[model samples]
Target: MAQVLEFKLPDLGEGLTEAEIVRWLVQVGDVVTVDQPVVEVETAKAMVEVPCPYGGVVTARYGEEGSELPVGAPLLTVAVGEPSAEPEGSGNVLVGYGTQAPAARRRRVRSAPAGTAAGTGPADRTAAPRNGHAVQPAAAPATAHARVTAPAAARPQATAPAPAEGPVPVISPLVRKLARDNGLDLRQLAGSGPDGLILRADVEGALLTGTAPARTAEETVVRTPVAPAAGDGTRIPLKGVRGAVADKLSRSRREIPDATCWVDADATELMRARAAMNAAGGPKISVLAMLARICTAALARFPELNSYVDTEAREVVRLDHVHLGFAAQTERGLVVPVVRDAHARDTESLTAEFARLTESARGGTLTPGELTGGTFTLNNYGVFGVDGSTPIINHPEAAMLGVGRIVPRPWVHEGELAVRQVVQLSLTFDHRVCDGGTAGGFLRYVADCVEQPAVLLRTM
Candidate 1:
């Protein structure tokens, strides 16, 4: 009997309510093994490959690529050993949890902590058991603390003193391969590791110490940028992150009824505040920092705006804490890295976190959690000096705020025309969820906060 098992999309990580289907690695009717990457999902930040939990043939794909699916929604149907009509729990397992099976016959067993079960997959390899029989695995490497070792009965004594911290571990596999192939002395060089791990710096250091070959003049030549041929418009393929962005933007424009409202305000005070903060600096702060802080405070006053619409439930899921996501333009595409509990953070912490988030996003090192669960989004078009532009609403969220360029403009001050730094604000909302009144109020609140920088401190 060929059983049909419906595999629902599992929760990728913390606060990830939904994911955008980036690509399908396997087509329908394709045989997939347990832990094989069956699909790729893009959650605001990075694209992650989702593996199959069970070995079976893919019966049907429930959702198409480029579709935004909620967590626990049916992703695909797999034919295991039973028919599709089988009940949910007769033998089937839920998403994230493995398949249901009878309890293992216990001999004399020991216990393991949570998330300690070793995964039997190519992504993670566990050392074979010394007992010569396949048994429960020990020391799963999911966590950083996990170490591969022989059975507890047989252990070796530690001999070497662990290497001290500093730049030495940051060397990439490619760099290591290059060094080995070229017979470079890695130990002779100083490292430029994250915390000072031995990286290319150490390799260069070896050359300085006469332990490695010095680069030839030909190898040190800098290449100049070439002008493209006339009428040859370069068409970059929108694949991976860029492709995903296009799909989402198209979907948002096509599906959501976006209502955009614009406001012009004096940004002289906000600009001054940013200048003062930059002068006093720890991390180099920008106008984006002030906008983020203002948005955090404003969301509190207009909680209805800081929410996502659940279409299935036809209810507005208002988030209690503000997780403000910023639209950062990266080489890959636009990535929205969520600042978890933005309301709880101070100016300094928020600035630092923003820097970390942008760094991680650009470096392609953001964790699953950092990209998920954004209540609201802020896009700074001001950097490019746009007066106002209608921004696409990030799906699920009711609205997205766009900040336009702040330039000196003539305005009335005490019955006299005066020049002041002014910027236009654009707020686009999903009309189905948020009414005109709610949207207007939210924009007004945000504009007020930005216009009066002191309101942020008072609100906090």
Candidate 2:
């Protein structure tokens, strides 16, 4: 007899409450090793490969790809212990949780009798070799509430119960919600997905074919709409990263009394300094990294801006260490990846970390910790060729410094009109954190450093 264990999505940390399933790495009946990635999920912060802690034959998967499941919800069930010959797991944890040794190669468990539920009965069915090929078992009648494992050969001919008679083979909650909203009985329709799994498409297809009648206006449930009117245009659901950004920005606006200050600065010296550094070369420093270094220096000078207003405590808390956040735009959306203790890192280290974080942001591999805990933010909108933007302060943080495109512009240099590389800097600060004097002093210090890069030596 094998003991069946259920694995739920672990808390991925940083206050995240839920995640959307991106892909399934294992199938029912596949043997999985401990700490092996069983599924990939996308939280608002990043894409994460969730590993199963228990090693066993996968008995059932609970959700479909693209489905959102709350934390602590069942992800899958694994059948462990028994007359099974698979190696026992080392009981190691995922990255950041603890150290884990290399997992042993996965071996398939011998299939049990056709009608036996997983984790039950003796090994009476035909046993297959330890080769990678899957063992196909005889097809059994599908159950309404549980997913049954069968051999690949039986999938094509498997008969699913009628929707009107048994539980519908549906995995996604969104599909169930869609059916409910349209007053459709899921049990009546035959699913087209594997093992007769009812998908969103199946429900949608039934609607198009007029198989399910639309609810009347009076019967329709009224709720806050996520998207706009149907005739307006295509409505993208405000979910995932985009939704998180929207909610944060909205809350920042609602709660914070913020003020913006802007200035034009000569960045010719900063550019020249960067060129000289690169020419002297070990590792090429990025302009964003230089700007970040300057921001850290400025924060050190005006520590008030490096603080957040604790509304519940009715006090402004100033932080000592700078966890510098830099905004990077990716296909997913705008994400701010933070560099820890940035005030303590040199320009070279900052450049390397920025490059690493930016790459991770682009690849959607940043962890929740990497994306949060910033005391200050550096927004280099200059990369986008924009002149200026009054950026919204990342909530709970005191201020964000926005840098715009640096281009040759007319400016007075040494009392003579000359073409100099000029850039626009804007500081958005929470009014409650500090007065305009503090914000202005910080921006002015940043501008001075940009105009004269050597001035950074005093802080260094």
Candidate 3:
């Protein structure tokens, strides 16, 4: 018997719990090999290609293009295990915990017999092909839990410690498939197995006692979320990159007691220094890199702003290393790609790293590893032709420095009024980390470095 296996959305780590399907690469009925890219998804401002592990015929796909899917929602199902062959899988498509080959056991599959009506509702989930013959959602099963998958052999292994908590703590693919086919959300059922593990008996019991509600088989097997049609004048979905950005900013606003400080400085010296550095002919340095270097120097002096507040432990976590994040606006969306260690890098290194990250951001190829664990953020809204902005802190970071356009405006240079390269700098910091004095001190030091690039030498 050909066994059909479901592939759910894997966790696109670093706190990203959902992704929007951007495109579909395979169709139902298409025979696929192990580790083939099956779909394109955008999560946390990055586009990632999801690969299927099993080499088999695609049986069904879930979700439509532009639809959102949670971490553990079903992505697709594949029919493997041909009459005589044992199908192979790599299980390395996801980052961690490579899933192994499916159990080779001959546990009976309970599909309906010929001429008998297939029991309707979730129990009979079918695969719909793409290409208009039938529709397969680019955005499949958006949103759900991220659970660890344990093989059948491992499933029966007795537990020694207390039951681990979080997400769906269930075993038995047979039971899970049963629930999915019957339109039962595994999360809703109470597991009577060890440590709240959901067992086959519990699910069957729920169905028999009318405890779990199931949809009819005629209902769509996969979730096909409807997006607004062109010119339909509907509210734009706050999903994918947009949704992730909104959530981070909203959380920063809600939890952070923030304050903003701004000052206009004669960036004439900073620009001149950059020009000189380029004239000397190495890989040219960017003004943003200069500013980032200054920020790192300033952060070293005033480390208070480089730390975030721990609400649970009620402690202020001060980080020794600097993982600097810079805001890059690309066609995909605004993504903040982080430099591993900003404090240690020179301007040349910063410039190169910034260029690399910007290119990746534009291509939507940045990984979660490149986008998270930031100590502070640098927002260069200057390219947008703006003067300044009170930037929202990229939580759970303590601060963000906003840079405005560098224009030749009339400024007091030395003691005379002159048309010089001047730029506005704004710092938005969490109030819990430090007072206005410390924040003001950090900003003033940054301004000093911008006015006279040599001022950075003091801290360097």
Candidate maximizing TM-score: 2
Name the TM-score of candidate 1: 0.52
Worst 10 residues of 1 by lDDT: 222-231
RMSD of each: 19.3, 7.4, 12.6
What's the TM for model 3? 0.71
Better of 1 and 2 by lDDT: 2
Candidate 2 lDDT over 93-204, as tens digits, reads 5543221332223324456546556743222122231243223333423333234333222233235445455567775787898777657778777765555666565666
Error of 2 at 379 (Å): 0.2
Give the alpha carbon lDDT tens digit for every residue of 1-460 in model 1: 4444545566665444556777899987799876677887776447676766667777656556765555655566565653232223324333332333211112233454466653222212223223432122244435432332221112222233225544334346745764554455454444433233443434434434455644345433421123122123543434445756787789888877889998888788888888887788577676776788888777777777888777788787888988888888887688788999888887778888889998988876566567667888989877775788999988768788999888899987668999988889889988877688888887887777767788777776
In the range 1-460, model 3's lDDT, one tens digit per residue, is 4555667677677767667789999987899888888999888757988887777888767767766565665677776664334445674645531243443333354564454343321212233333522222232231121122322112242334223455666556766876765566667676654345666655665565666654544543342133211233433445667778988999999999999999999988888888888999879888889999999999999999899899999999999999999998877677899999899999999999999998888888888778888999999999999998999999999999999999999987779989999899999999999999999999999999999999888767
Q: Report the CA-based lDDT of candidate 1 relative to the real structure.
A: 0.64
For model 2, name the residue pairs that clash.
Answer: 163-187, 163-188, 164-187
**Top-lDDT candidate index:** 2
lDDT of each: 0.64, 0.76, 0.74
